[model samples]
Target: MNIQTTLKLCSVAALAVALSACVRVSTDSGDNAAAQADAAAETLQDAAAGAEPADAFLARLARHCGQAFEGRIIANEPRSPEPHAFEGKTLVMHVRGCDDPTRELRVPFHVGDNHSRTWILTRTDSGLRLKHDHRLEDGSDDPTTMYGGDTATAGTAQRQEFPVDQASIDTFNARDGLSVSVTNVWAMEIDPGQRFLYELSRPQDDLNPQGRLFQVEFDLTRPVDLPPTPWGY
Candidate 1:
């Protein structure tokens, strides 16, 4: 080839190599950025995965942890005979154990002098769960224990509702012959420095004239001294 043409060809080859090198550098930079972004996203997810939607509500309840409050039943009727036993007694609920990630809270309810019941709230993958843990004074499990329900929605931060689950229904039916309890719904509400309420209701039907709803409210503004240890640890 001619000298001029050969020199021109050499210049073209050098330019091509330089362009290829630039392209490789640009690709590597993009890949590194993408990797950094992915790592950041994964770290955020790890922090959030340990939290539940009902975390705010759980925190509110936890605020009262290690404290006790007096309560009184405001609604009666359509309730199991068990509630009547709490009447004419000093009703107290002591917010006991609290573990956020596992989402478990143990609040022992003291009726008059009987410390046989505990209200347990737990966090599930879907939402939340509430269970009534009853025990004898000697700490033996009650035959009709662990009957409660799971949350049906992403309830507000101040409140959450739990519609009776099948397990609760079966327990009620087997223990008390209350097959109708399958339609029961329970809810808990907390307003910091105001009041905390626990409620139960059933769907309206021929048996229930207007559907049975029972609620008990505690004075949150006042935290009384802690009571004796609950029946079960």
Candidate 2:
């Protein structure tokens, strides 16, 4: 989805569901060289778990086993604001088990470039979280990733744990910056049949003298899916 570049370019903001901060994100020189190692170990673990064993990306897509749904990017800015490169996209989501109280893949997203990172999401009454199914080219433990989003500042996000909430599902949408006068997210859906929508909006007080803000929606669909995880682990 190229969102890795988008996320890398702009920081994620708290949806006001929680008082969060920035997540410090980093990577090592031996990127793909290590991915393969992690995959092998994970593959073996999957076989032991009795969960479906999937590789490449078909396996990941299998997890999403429900009807197609739409996703809209609601803007955190004025109504007539500029166009977001990744705005207005619908994703067919296969929320395997949102009915589960403790965990749910109600929402999932493609991490960086297509086939790179796969994220599973879970939501609770108080807040939400996620699991980062990370791996290297050779199935090895990847460099420990630390992500902390910004609560209300610049270049200051919480470390990528959530270590508190790390290893959970909502890591992909975690924030590392404050919601500015303009706030919004570039929403994308993995399901191929869904339609693109946008929930554009701006904060009440931040409105201009006209007592209004600029927000808009458009369509840009590129059907995509998650990469397979050998195990649900």
Candidate 3:
């Protein structure tokens, strides 16, 4: 090759090397920035988990969203017809519709052939709130619906307690005439990738001095197939 041609080739090779180096530097900067940003986010989440118990609990439950688990009544007291209704029937709870931005979650509880109950959890300014949304098979709201409560204490990441609030008591007495439920206290426990438990009890009083207790537990180790659309969505 001629001298000029060799000089041209060398210039082109130098330019190519410079360009490659520039590209590598750019890529390394971007990757480093992304990794640093991810680390910052994780740190913030960890701090939040330590500061807020409700947020931590909700985060754990959100992990199970879009999954359904089978459950059975583990404990019951003050024998009644309601317990019999769940006997010999498939019980399922489907965690669905997690809106983290809005801090709301909807979990549908299906008892055998009934798909009328959906448990709604919302992150209120004060604390966490639980409301029962019951609907008819045709998707109409039940008159005796929306009877749950807010968290009274800072529960653990795996467990939350909800004692019936005055609003729930008023609603129950007015709508269903069930004045005895004014002292109801409900609880939910979650063992991520293991189990979930729901419990209800009433404090001792003149109306319900014996104190009612009902509990149902779900196996979360294995997720079942999605069931039919819950009534009223």
What overall lDDT goes with each candidate model? 0.81, 0.33, 0.83
Count clashing residue pairs in model 2: 69
Top model by TM-score, which number? 3
**Per-model TM-score versus the true fold:** 0.72, 0.27, 0.76
Clash number for every model?
0, 69, 0
Ranking by lDDT: 3, 1, 2
RMSD of each: 15.9, 23.9, 13.9
Q: Which residue pairs come into collision in candidate 1?
A: none
Q: Give the alpha carbon lDDT tens digit for every residue of 1-233 in model 1.
A: 99999999999999999999878767755645554454455435535665454776786677678889999999987666474876888989999887553478888888878888899999888888999999988999988889999999988666899999988888877865677677889999986656789998988886566788888899976789899998978
Native RMSD of candidate 2 (Å): 23.9
Model 3 Cα displacement at 97 (Å)? 1.5
- 148-202 per-residue lDDT for model 3 (tens digits): 9999888876688999988888887785458888898899997666679999998
